[model samples]
Target: MHWSTLVDAVVVAHQPHSADPARYDIVLGAGVRSEESLFDLPAAPRFELFAGTTVAAASAGRCSAVDGLFKPRADPAPVPMELIGCEPAEPLLAALRRPRRSERNWVHLLVLDRHGAEMASRTVGLAITGARPSVLGGTLIDITLTDGGDERPSLAARPIWAQWYQGPPAEPNLWAPYDTQGRAAWLDLTTRAWRVPAPRPDRSGGEHHLDGRFVTDVPGLHCAIAEALLGPGRYFGREWNAFKDCLCGGFGVAPPFTLTWHDAEIARRALADVVEDQEDGLSYFEDIVRLLERYGVTVVLR
Candidate 1:
């Protein structure tokens, strides 16, 4: 009787890290078989044997000797083998023989990024036909970035050190060290003291600490010394009123002028003069706060 046979199989190949092109190793799976060859067999053979059993034995032996099959090298690394998928041909069951050449296959290559992110994957077609051993491989992929336009000016001075003070004091304080071209500078932390640079500018420098505490070396305390004398909102409003009174007295203006007029014409000029000296000082503290934020440091500002 004549019989029809079918075979199904999957093959995979990979190059080990230590493998060199001059020498290559190949691995094969047992289930691989050719459908045309299996169909040529008779339904009832003169002798009957199990094809699966024979294939299994061959697979075991091949896998065991795989390491020895490769050329010897300074360092030999063992490559793992796997049979991912399999199927059998019907008539081939009675023959109980080794796999014919056509049924093998391999997996596609995948590329990954530096962070282990998958960048791309593509199927690589086999070059040779009816080849005995399967081949597997991989290649590296690269990423590139483009620039966008927006330019800003650089700062003349850079901050080297900064710290936030959380201890109970008049108000929250920020300390910072700045490189100001050879100028005598005193930072009021607790009090003002000279910042001495060490003999080796890079290796050592004079250090000064500031806080709310009264230190003889430092000249000024961090807190506003005349808070009680000025009272709440007194400076802001008193300065405004004084300026308005002066303007009206000078212009010979009479009463009944609206508060809005006083604010726009006279008060604005007066307040500007009062706050002029303190503007740059306040900005120094703000710059320190900005630097700390840039460095991912959390700061409590009061």
Candidate 2:
């Protein structure tokens, strides 16, 4: 079926490179109604280590700093889904009859908006584990879905996902005053907004002014920087390491540009409350300004 046929479909199975590029619908409503698992991501594993005797000292009421490590990506858990009133095409039915570990069984599960636009998508290896009769008068299929790619948004960030599902906003700084988690979610959404990499940095060395009134925290700083560099609700990076990667290329605006920051004093005091990376020995604002200078950006502070 054509892609447009699946508009407003609760769940869709898409095959992009197939001869017909079919998008099959996985209808909702009936016996299965709980959808909390669809929005949750798996917990990440973190390892923490302390110096010898540090643990003992901590037990004795002495404080000691510990080193922590985490992977960039987490191993995702399988999504248990129950589909009611699903009518599969012949090809999809044949594949589901004897599900195996094959490319044909791997499909993108798209979550659609009320208007039938894609809100979010995930690749999953689908297998029909069992089938039963729905009490409401239909077939109920139990499907076990293993993660093929893309982590789901965290619960803290689901509000942003819900907002974007309606479509992109028309204004800037909508994320202002939201705690760091919300602002971080805003940046994450920006990363997925475009299919291709961001355009090359502007070589004309144009002047981009930043409104620093809302730069109160680390993630807020990132949000302000994104809008300053790429316009409203755009993304440059979400963290310091990612920021550096954006500077090298692909995130719009190279060095030799001028950035005039307005209301800089607000961030100077507000960012002081944000404590991170004590080993860096510099405030968040200072570090950002220094990095910009190092990369050939002419920063004018007001």
Could you say which candidate leads in TM-score?
A: 2
Error of 2 at 259 (Å): 1.2
Q: After superposition, how far is residue 36 of candidate 1 from its true place, in Å?
A: 91
TM, every model: 0.12, 0.60
Q: Tell me the whole-model lDDT of each prediction, alpha carbons only.
A: 0.24, 0.62
Q: How many residue pairs clash in each candidate?
A: 14, 2
lDDT of 1 by residue, 1-302 (tens): 32112133223464543545644344433332223332333343342112221112111111212232123335333222221221233332222232232123223443333434333333432222221121332221121111111111123211210111222122321121222220002122221111121222211112212222221111111121111111111110112223233223322222222111111222222223322123242222333333334433343321
Error of 2 at 105 (Å): 6.3
Local error of candidate 1 at residue 66 (angstroms): 88
Q: What lDDT tens digits, residue by residue, belong to model 2 across residues 1-302?
A: 10001122242232343333452222222222222323322254232322111112111111122111111335456555555555545655676666674434666666555566555576665666654454446444333443434455567777887877776555778888578888888887777664344356355488988889898888888888878877876778887778877887766667778888889888878876443345454666877888889988899998
